[model samples]
Target: MSERSAGLLLEARGVGKSFPGVRALQDMHLELRRGEVLALVGENGAGKSTLMKLLSGIYTADEGEFLLDGKPLQVSGPRDALEQGISIIHQEFNLMPDLTVAQNIFIGREPRAGRVFLADRALEAKAAELLDRLHLPLRPGQRVGDLTVAKQQMVEIAKALSYDARILIMDEPTAALNDAEVRVLHDLIRRFRTPDTAVIYISHRMDELKAISDRITVIRDGRYVETLDTATTTMPEVISRMVGREIAGGAGPEGVRDDRPVVLSVDRLSTKDLLNEVSFELREGEILGFAGLMGAGRTEVARALVGADPVASGTVSLRGKPVRITSPAEAAKHRIGYLSEDRKQLGLLLEQDVNANIGLSSVKERFQSFGFVRAKAMRARSRELVDALRIRTPSVDQTAKFLSGGNQQKVVIAKWLVKDCDVLIFDEPTRGIDVGAKEEIYRLLNDLAAQGKSIIMISSELPEVLRMSHRIVVMSEGRVTGQLAAAEATQESVMHLATLRPETETVR
Candidate 1:
């Protein structure tokens, strides 16, 4: 091999993979040099996951080949790939929640005391040694299910490193982590870099790519686009390459008019668990953004307002009329809809068709007649919404799980719109969506506001909160620390309030 080829740690050349009626990847090429981090970025269905699966042995390529250290690489399965020093941590963790940390890490490879018995202590000791070497703050005896999302993520990293992996592939590792957690993850990644090791990092967060990657490889429509050096390339340029078009910059929300009537008002909202005397107001034709850290009770407030959680004491007023909400159905009766942060489990019905999912929320009032569903009317409405939201699907009858993340989120929005909800609560609406899809969702939210819908948008992304909110509510430790108009909200100012404790002076 040439000197240049020897310097490369891993390479995919002319790789192509396809399934029935769909070409997931074609001519996909990637390169990772020793001691560097390579970021693979693309839209939701842009073949990023396909490429990773191909590399990790979850899927085999129909054509072309992969090389490790300029040598042909072959693996029969995921275990074989790991044995060959290629370890992958998928976005949806592969951990067994019921098992302890050590058990989950060394599940099938536990040390044996003899031919029949397992050496449980030896397995735990090995796991403990590995975690200590990696500087992860985790106990081997702790139950995986009891750990926080961030700690669980660290456990995943430790498991991947346990294989003595030469090439580590991390898929959206920081997706569920807060800013502080992300910094910890980055530090770990940095420490893992060595002359004989490299990483392939996949993520949708633009800012994180700039911070962690040495080079970026962009793909679109199952085709290789270009790779750019992270140090010199602008994020906008990277995004443009991923989507094959320039994205227009959007301005922050204009301050809502004071003359607008108050649509939803909360007075001393409190829940037994987290929320404590939280309060906010939503005006007609306004977007109220909720900003906070991961555990700051932003989602708890949404749940309490929608009756998904038990409220200890509070008052909810709808257009000056007080009402009691004891369940989600009651909230719906009041025309208040909540789209959860976990769209897959809490929002969308994955097994159902798009038409069914969209019309489900309004079935009783609009699509049900004489105790039977009005299938024709429901189909008509679903089709209209599919077009209106620009939801990409072959047909409304297509199953919800078959659609991409972006389209699934759009279907959830359509459900609430069909119900004619006056007040909508969207928690992490764009969490796992691609940048292009995020722009579409942002436009949809703004359009809803223009059509006189009062929206409560909860997001951990400070830039998104600042850009899309007419007014922002900052929460810390389940309390309202401060509120800011669009003109006055900056990342630093919002973070100051986000970290403020309830014991500090509150801003009403």
Candidate 2:
């Protein structure tokens, strides 16, 4: 389809939306044509979401209007937009846990067999057909809560399709998907797009956007930037536009004190279904990198080492002393800390205040044993971490949910620092962080290492694995494929090891 007005399927002009104090979208404009995949990109809270909400009718536009199929339309709510063939699959899913796949898909409008009675069998049969057609490998009768996160997401997609949506808004759909699962989702998206279907995909992974998008639309700070043909636009160019800089923060500091003593050592560590005789040493003043594909057991090893998950067998020693850790509390007692890759689920309690989350793990220690928490002392300590981490916030009392992605990460980092853990494990440390925040986080890691702290950082990005690691450990499935020093490692070498094994191997 051409870029001209006649070929366009959707035209959103001068669109704007606002919250209590924030003008979420200002003069935002977007265009999409038949059978085209448009990528919308920006840092978190950069008005990309607001624009999407307006399009999907989650929020009515404060100004301007959207024209769908040459006719101007008013969307009072999500249902209205859905009726107009607009469907949005959000980053955070909206699925009912207790509901079955079929129940969820046709929740508002279940088929009525006779006398206004629900036709459950027919609904399940129809949902099963959709699942089969989409290659979801799911049963209509299956409950959403019983399914994995990936499967639940599949249910969401099927539900959207059931709306007969022509314009599909996919907001970070692959964020929770593994590499193999991502491939499947990508294929499904491509297949689902008919001549009338216009897919708008929002993703942070530059590589995936390159693979899936036909056109790229970038927004920055509530303003429309530009739209470019995906084939003609490069990731660097897109990143430059997104951050308004040539910033690249995946590669952190290197060569962290080669002569320093090893602080954390895992000699043939084994965990059930995870670590398979994996062996690695973390130096006192080093950031050791772990590189592997998703579901390759990278986070599993981190969990086992941190005592979040139990080890089936093997040795985990701290500073040459053997330690028996069966629980996360025990791991903390040994001064070992782990930051989860999924901060929202496993790391931070989004509903709690900054000080509350920071002191959640070790409240008694941070606060004096006054029998009651020393509110004054806790505030001071939390503030110290907030300042040290450069957390962008108005006050320490702010809920983590209200904070930006970067600040929320800082709160997680602060929480661990209050524990004063000697060995720190950062799993996908900058997964969804912005460039500015990422650079700051990298520097923080460097500072921690310089302060004689041992770090084991697990990351999926190849550049990060090469740049920050004093020594790199490559894993495929559950086994360590190989280990190489910073001086000897390259992206291709690490990738080769990352894809070597199909089935999970034991690190111990």
Candidate 3:
């Protein structure tokens, strides 16, 4: 073997995989060197997940092969893959919430006093040693469900490492984490890296790739694109390679006129939990952004406004008239719609087709006449929206779950549009979506604003907040700490407000 090949810990040689009517991966190849973090980046449907699954033995490759330490690698399943020194942590966690941390980590391999009896104390003791060795801030006795999302994620890492995995695969590890949490997670990864081990990290967050990855592999539409040194390649260059086009950076929405009519106003909006006296206004043809750290009540504010959560006190006004919205149904009646952050769980029916999901909210009001359902009308409207939104689908009959993350998001937006809602609340609109698709969503939002539809866009990404909002409201510990116009807002300024507490003086 050559000296360069000797350094490769894992190599995918002409790997290919396919499913019914979809070539998920084609001639895909990747190289991971000893003790380095290799970032795999691409659009949502670019087959990143498929490649990872094949590596972890969740799916077998239809063609080509994987070489581990310059030898053919073979595994029957995930368990077998772990036995072969490979571990994969998916974006959606696989932990059982009700189990204790120790129970979750050592699950099927719990220590036993004998072949007949399980040793509970021994199981926890083993987990404790692992946690202590890794320096993870988790108690073996702690219930997994009671831990925060960041803590829960640590459990997953601990579990993966427990198998003495030589190759670690992390999928979107920081997708749901805050800045502080991300720093902690990255520290753990750095500690885990050794000359005998390597990491394959998959994420769409460009900033994170710069911080964590040693090299980046770009793929597009199930095909290998290029690999570049993270230190030498600019983020925009990497993004261009991923999307096969130059992405022009642009400014946020221009200032909305002071004379613009106020479409929706919330005064002293308060909820029983996590939301204080929050106040904001949505002007016609404006994009009002909500920004904050995790658990700062940005989503809580949206829920309270749309009646998804109970409001202890506050007043809501629509078109300058006072209104009481006690439920989502009431909010819908007032032409208000909320597109939740957890689109798969809360927004769309995964089993249903695009046409059904798009027209679902308006079935009673628009797609029904004299107690009769109008399938033809729904299909036509859905097709029109599919075209308008540029949703990539073979047909409206395609299942919602089958579409990419970006297209699924667009379908949710179309649902709100079909309902004729003037006030739209979008929480984390582009979360888990690729950069190219994010650009499309940004343009779509601007188009909607131009059409005079007021929008409330809540995002955890500061860049997104700054790029899309006409005005931004910063929240900290469930309170509106400050509001900034697009021209005045910067990441540093927004972060300052996001960390400001109730005891601190506020910014207007």
The models' CA-based lDDT, in order, is 0.88, 0.81, 0.89
Worst 10 residues of 2 by lDDT: 499-508
Compose the digit string of candidate 2's lDDT tens values, residues 367-455: 86758878888889899888887786668887787665656878898899899989899987876665556677888888888888888
Candidate 3 per-residue lDDT, tens place, 329-446, comes to: 9999999999987677589999999999999879999999999999999999999999987787778988887776667888998999899889889988887788888887888899
The Cα error of candidate 2 at residue 144, in Å, is 5.9
- TM-scores, in order shown? 0.90, 0.83, 0.90
List residue ranges in candidate 2 displaced over 4 A.
Answer: 1-5, 76-80, 95-163, 178-181, 248-258, 359-362, 367-395, 404-407, 502-508
Candidate 1 wrongly placed segments (more than 4 Å) = 99-106, 109-155
